[model samples]
Target: MTDKNPDKGFVALLGWSLNAIEAVDRFDRRYVVVAPPWAEDYCRQNDIPFVPWDFDRLNERSHELALTLEDMGVDVAIPIFEETVEWAGAVNAVLLKNPRLLGQAMLFRDKSLMKRRAQLGGIRVGVFEEAHDRGDVIRFLKRVNQTLLKLDGDPNDPIHFKAFDKSGTAGHRVIRTPEDVDNIPDEEFPALLESHLDGWEFAVEAWIKNGKIEFLNISEYVTLGYSVFVPATPELEAHRERITEEIEKLIEVFDIDFGFIHPEYFLTSDNKLYFGEVAYRPPGFNALELIERAYGFNGYQGLVLAFDPKTTQEELDAFFPKEVVDAKGHAGCFGVYPRRRVVSRLQVPEETANHPYFEFHELSDPREQKVAKRSAFGTHWGLAYFFGDNAHDLRDLLKRQEELDYYV
Candidate 1:
């Protein structure tokens, strides 16, 4: 329990979350937080030194984070979540200008910028357009002729729609045909429409350091009957290798010297690889921990070491398990609140409370109405994470929980 002195070394994690990274752990180098002030209590409880900043403006926020860290004598910064993307470039701009500060975070935000950079490096990426309004959506759809149109579309297209500002299953809707357009209001919603891939969805996890890409882990996602999570099988290995190779090329192209990325891919029946989307930060489903288990590398540790090139991979390995079992994989499922406009006090097997891999379980009551947001393609409420010896076992475990049944 040695103190992390700012003068010695410290890392800054932005967009704070309790479970994703060890931002507040005692063993971490002195930690400086660039998050809302409300998180100060959590920092104090964990003995982690922190510096709070506003999120109103990305540039200003970045500058402020740098100034705060410098005042505290911190030499390096590593962001833990994506919310910090808004200001990452500005912070890196500051660091790049000042000689000694380490680590860069610009490629993590702005999908259009990342993809353009990736393509230049020879990484095959799906055609994509950044749409900010209804007009943008229409224009992009017209250009692609295969709009995964999200707003004001016919309800019969079987297209799923979502807004840019929305996360964790919010701001999602489906447009089945032209008639469904009438159901949406005329107000603008920042959304993107892309051709949907009808195949297995996969998330490839990697850590890039000094332009070298290390494939950390891969997860096979079954989005058919449900979005189930499992370890990658042999059928997905080739696709994973190809994607990994392409991602490595992207790293060299982008000069992503030090960071983690979650690039999602789709493998069709013919094994044709299709890029889905990429997130510069860690995956959303607490999947980082799984990565740590599978690769025997502490993603958070590697993140910290990315700045200090001298830090050995051995040190990172010491922080993670040497081997992870496919049987130890986890399944994640989501269930919405009751579909009625009243209080939905449903009950379930209390055993769910003790499930080993139940990473998160909660009830969304934003409107105080028991009814959850209605949508065919978006998750409504109540998510469960459980591990099993295999994908089927995990799925069956979720089914048996019977905790997700709806009630008005």
Candidate 2:
């Protein structure tokens, strides 16, 4: 059967995920976008067609969107938000019902399922126990305590702690004591009690197409914080080949399809690698651009292409280079506004903007009102993107930007 659709072209659903959609824009094909309602004006200005869709409500909204787009015969539905992962199953349901659709979505939301599936396929991940409250926490902590505690130790020996759940960083906490254990709120804790990895962090970036894993790059996390990602050095680099092989195994075992994945891991002092976490989307850092800088192909753009049936994975892989992609200069990093807080103003001197190292910057208008932070949901108030041939220059500029306080 020939894969040709004269009437139905490609359609892409994007939320506030500007980078992913913009990356998709690099392709020659036309894209019909289903995005946040707020994006309508931006779409109009950019000459991209806009369809209203709420990324917040996945089951209902996505199912509704699936049906609506079914009529339009969209070839692809890609989500930019981590939250939209809930729609993965729903979209899969629709895709299964209609096999013509390009991909399947599963294990994208629940971290436990994601890890369990990966481990069964030989993926090296952290040892995690799913816990509910004090009982679960206590039981799991006891196990960790027994394993780590030394003989003739103090009766009140402190225990290092970590956690796992659906939420990122928020789902994790450092538990130092029994008292600290109790501090874990019932509502906030979902899956808990994970043994902390002592080694440095590395991220395996890949694209799974037709059950094939294309290992793009392994990124080491130099500095991790509220909103910063620095690169890892060669010494810090961990099991790139093993991780890639295992991930490929998981893709087949799980039956995942054309999509971008970021699998995080930690290497022990002995060089033993442990899985940390995985995101079904692109890297939080503009790691794609960095990868592209190192390799001629665009990692983010390849992700977008994976959604289009006309674009084959082989074609995408051919475009990527064999060597590790690196930033041109020494040390550099990127940061988001601290927390969910609003960006009252992102004050950057014009000099910084004109700098060759300064790749991009974004700011939320503080204006008359304060930037809101603690809400269950809100977009980034401001973002500052920096890129320099010299990593040191980028680092220095970030240091200067960090000193300025947000008014709200």
Candidate 3:
């Protein structure tokens, strides 16, 4: 076990993530991993402080874990994944003696509720509604297209279907026509549907303290769910002031005081910024790692500092570096999904491997010869990393990867 400052907050991390665990292991603040029982043996071997608990849906038994952590003198609970966000809130509400925290976490978990809350707070958002079945989805698609006055021959504007609680693109699908609605499985019903916003989509990572923004980094996406780079290009960077204001508004609306927030936004051609959705935990696609690569700082440690009530202004001020100015270079990653229907092996294209920006990849050999049909935004096989001094070159390099074959 690493030495910890007894005076600092003792946090309960309500999920298992190696990156987060490694960060807390080296930081001053003490933490305990509250994960499923499967991790018990690993935690014991590694000497990691652990409390095993399955994060199933909350029930009457949920308070037992909260009381247990409170008895352990835990000051707060930090969620590392979407599944644990509600768990963290439930536990923190008991530990911090604030019941409202649970409600706030729900806003981060449920997309339908989140949009309603954002709209009530006067945040701009695209047209959206909850869908309970295929009929509901079809009706929504027709209504959205009709509202746009889309002619019968005109291509229907696509609408998005997303699971209320799943993270990333786990249960996301794009419905462009009535026939497309038939492809949705019955289990994926009770989802949130939204009109596709035509604009530049980007995600913001903000660390807040005392209802103020301490540090914010923009992650520019080359293609949604495919590639993203930190400390966005100059054109996107120029809107920092406007973006910051929107973040401040999010803080006010969400009543968020501390910890990290990963919220996505779309800047329309008209320059109007529309709120997408926000997650209370760290973003997927290795965004924190990319941020750490671009700026010489540990983002998971930043999460600890932000959540620790004992953290002082001097500590935060000294921790994060200047946004774009402090970045060493642009760090980006492209998620690789096999383009072909069947693949016998994983092959990194020579053009990709020879590129100056190419750093490395996480791809491995194929486990099977047949690749299944992808539903919605399916999972990527792995990611390829890159770094360069020029953002445009990095962006172009990432975009070009989509055309290359990574498997055969």
Considering every candidate listed, which one attains the maximal TM-score? 3
Q: Candidate 2's residue-wise lDDT over 1-408, tens digit each?
A: 123345433646555666656665765555667766888898889866678877766354666777776667666666666665556446645744644222234465667677787778776766677776677767766676677764544453333333342434544556646676776666765664566667666677777666666555666554443233333344443355666665676567556666777777777788676766677776655667666654556665576566566675467666555544433433334454543244444455666566676665555555644445432222334556655454345445666655545333
Instruction: Give lDDT tens digits, candidate 1, residues 78-131.
Output: 656666654554565554464222223444454456556666666666666555
Q: Per model, how many backbone clashes are there?
A: 9, 6, 0
Pick by TM-score: 2 or 3, better one: 3
Q: Model 1 misses residue 147 by how many Å?
A: 10
Candidate 3 global CA lDDT score: 0.93
The total number of steric clashes, by the backbone 3 Å criterion, in model 3 comes to 0
TM-score of each: 0.76, 0.75, 0.98
The segments of candidate 3 whose C-alpha lies over 4 angstroms from its true place after superposition are none
Winning candidate number (lDDT): 3
Question: Model 3: per-residue lDDT, tens digit, 294-381?
Answer: 9989999999998888999999999999989999999999999998989999889999999999999999999988888888989999
Candidate 1 C-alpha error for residue 91, in Å: 2.0
Model 2: per-residue Cα lDDT at residue 396:
58
Q: lDDT of all predictions, in order shown?
A: 0.55, 0.58, 0.93
Task: Give me candidate 1's TM-score against the actual structure.
Answer: 0.76
